[model samples]
Target: MSRHRQRQRERGQAAVEYAGVIALLLFVALAAIQLGVAAYAAQQAGTAARAGARAASMPDGDGQAGLAADAAVSSWLTPKTQSGSCGDQITVSVTIDIPQVLPIFDFGSARRSVTMPCD
Candidate 1:
């Protein structure tokens, strides 16, 4: 009877240890996923900047920098854009709010800029 009780107590301790390990692994996986989301947001911002600048540089097209930028990225990662002319060149800047995987990690936003000569 004494040996059986000791074995049961050890099994309970082992179960608790496994639960703690699984929780830790889950947190690490979540952090990795959040980092990937940040990288994707940065890449999207760059794409939006290039597309907007290309559109802005067209001599025959009406200026629609915002429209081009919005079409270049995911719908959830909508980009805010600003365009200006410096001499013969046009520059477009794009900013996007990074998606949150965990509420505690609000890493703000990503931004990118591109310049292209006017056609």
Candidate 2:
């Protein structure tokens, strides 16, 4: 009876260990997902800057730079675009907030700049 009771007491040990490991695994997965979101946000910023610069470089694209940048970014992200100097070169800068998948850390924002020759 004593040996049977000891065996019964240890029966759930594996489950307890697994429970601890599962928590760690979940944290790691969340971190990886957060990193991926950050990368995507940075890519989106670059795309927005490029599109805006291309628009600003054109003869008829002076006022359409903002629209082109807004259209290039993903709907889920809001972009802040700044354009300057369209004489010899057109420069556009785009900033986007990175999504926070994990509440433990603040990922802040991503920024990109592009310059294109005026056409």
Highest lDDT against the true fold, candidate: 2
lDDT of each: 0.89, 0.92
Task: Give residue 24's lDDT in candidate 1 (0 to 100).
Answer: 95
> Which 10 consecutive positions of candidate 1 have the poorest summed lDDT?
58-67
TM-score of each: 0.90, 0.91
Report how far off residue 68 is in candidate 2 (Å). Answer: 0.8
* lDDT over C-alpha atoms for residue 61 of model 1: 36
State the lDDT of candidate 1 residue by residue for 48-112, as single tens digits: 99999998888753467888999999988889999986458888999999989989888799999
Question: Residue 58 deviation, candidate 2, in Å?
Answer: 0.9
